[model samples]
Target: MNLNIFIITSYSFFDQDLEKLFLCNLKYQDFSKNFKNYENYSKLSSNYKLDKSKHWITNVTHLFKFSREFKNFIKRYTNYYLLNCLIFVSIEFLPEKIASVVLGFISFQTFVDKFGTVFSIILVTILQMSNYHYTVLILTTFYGSWNLSEDLLIPYFNKIHFTMSEQNQWLNTRKGVLFGIGLVYYIMMQKFPLISFIIYSNAFFNMGFLITKITNEIPDNSKSLGTWSITESVWDGHDKFLGESLTS
Candidate 1:
């Protein structure tokens, strides 16, 4: 997981930085072509420096910024986590007979998604109900692996400028790989709870090298697993709210 995270983050960071450099160079080229006055050129250079300083400040204080994007991400993912828990708890509270029926319904929904969400709740519920304590513990470690993958890949997604639908499509197509990466991350977290963040920072670079290799070698037309309707709806709603908030 750490390696995957590292790879994705490294690719995204370098990609974005290269893009910025390209754009800045182009702007300078245009400015030079126009043969602006020395004072105007000086002003333009100062403005660029000012913008860079502001960007640095923003990065330094990002954790305390509470920007709209951060708020939206937190709200959306929190809803997903709560919805998953609610589904699991509701299933557990059902009578054994009815629980089976509910499980069938969940199975149907997952099938409709072509097993895109990986039927995670169904597996967890079954394991718990069957009283497979050790198995449940192990499975639980990887239960929210998808979410972890999504969290770690945010930089990559942003760098590529993927729309909501595009993001979902990309994720669905790579579900198995992402899940495996996330499972490794979960294992590390369990093994090194206190120093997990430090470990993650180091592994991030390692993951970037792997990502570079994978992207270079693999074609993009791989088969997709399926999309998560609930997640899609939540993202849609979040976007709508943001749009309306901005308009008003």
Candidate 2:
């Protein structure tokens, strides 16, 4: 969209503090090592330079620098999105009784867009495996609460990590927990066909997005291409579901 709008949203969401863009222009090593006195640092001001490279076009391909990860990400996510579109069509065609059950998939899509596809997928799978209507109801409320919690907690976590010397230890611990959780979901997916389909589809979406994140350095755009892609997908899904009602 508009550059100014993108910057404002990114500043609000991605850059919680004003420091990120400032730090991007600075050499972290220089600050860590050469901070003897204010005078010395002030004198060395001319040494730092901003990177002014061209950004990627947010298309399927880049001319000079080919990102294999980006390519694979596109391929995987396109397949997943198309499969979800098919599921939507099938849901639309079903009888009212069956459609009511399948209608839950629309809620799943909404959750996926909000909390992230992978996390939402795992959560829905867990709800399905629980086989309790009350449990599902509880989790639906929990998800809304959890989203609010993240907006407060994430900044605090980022501050803590920034200050702590044992940040790597905390990172490792978080990774271990995530891995364990993912493994549990994997096992759950094996038992349930619906869960399996959702888990795989969401996994594809998440994987592609993650790969794009890892390869973000290749793109010189200050705005996140991955964020744009997700927004585009969400709109596309919305249009597909609403059909001509979206226009009205």
Candidate 3:
């Protein structure tokens, strides 16, 4: 078990993803320091566009209800949370070392990769039906932590013009490290859900810095793990809707 834990831990930290987490923390600290300067503080305040006269709760509610980005975050968070839970449950039946290896490999796959998603979902459903409530709960919290960590680097990925497929492939090929970096941010977001948006603002710069470092180290030679018809269909539908929305 100790060896298993060490293997998992080593794999997760192999690419120094934890360094990216630290980088984000340092960036957040620098951002907080800017609040001490009136000009810098005012500049920062202008970006949020929150009305002072409104109740804080009302403003937050509005942000949750109407912010597209927030909605997308919620969607991604929920999906990944569930997916990770299933993955954790699936691996639990295996021996420690084998489980660790399986976990690492699956984590490297894209959420929608081929039949993996369907298989995981089916397995999770079977387990849930078997009444493993306590086990599922624990795994959900464990796997969900670093699941959405990639969201922080959206700005960098966008700047580099990486499509969803490309992004997944790239991350999949260089897995473990990004998961480690995301774990810290995930804990922070859980502890301070309301302030996540603010944290994300600072995270953008950190992502840019981290991505530059990552790209320099890892050459982008990630090949596709085959196409998922469902994913492609969804993307196509989304593009069609976007086109119509723009035209109208």
Best by TM-score: 1
How close is each model in CA RMSD to the real structure?
14.9, 18.9, 16.1
How well does candidate 2 match the true structure in TM-score terms? Answer: 0.25
Tens digits of per-residue lDDT for model 2 on 41-129?
Answer: 23322211222253334322341134322233334335444544544554467665554455356447646755788887776667555
Candidate 3, run of 10 with poorest lDDT: 38-47
Tens digit of per-residue lDDT, candidate 1, span 164-205: 565666566556656777777767865886776555554443
Where does candidate 1 stray beyond 4 Å? 1-72, 87-129, 132-143, 216-248
Cα-lDDT of candidate 2: 0.35
TM match of model 1 to true structure: 0.47
Per-candidate count of clashing residue pairs (backbone under 3 Å): 5, 0, 0
List candidate 3 segments past 4 Å from native: 1-134, 217-248
TM-score of 3: 0.37
| TM-scores vs. true structure, each candidate | 0.47, 0.25, 0.37
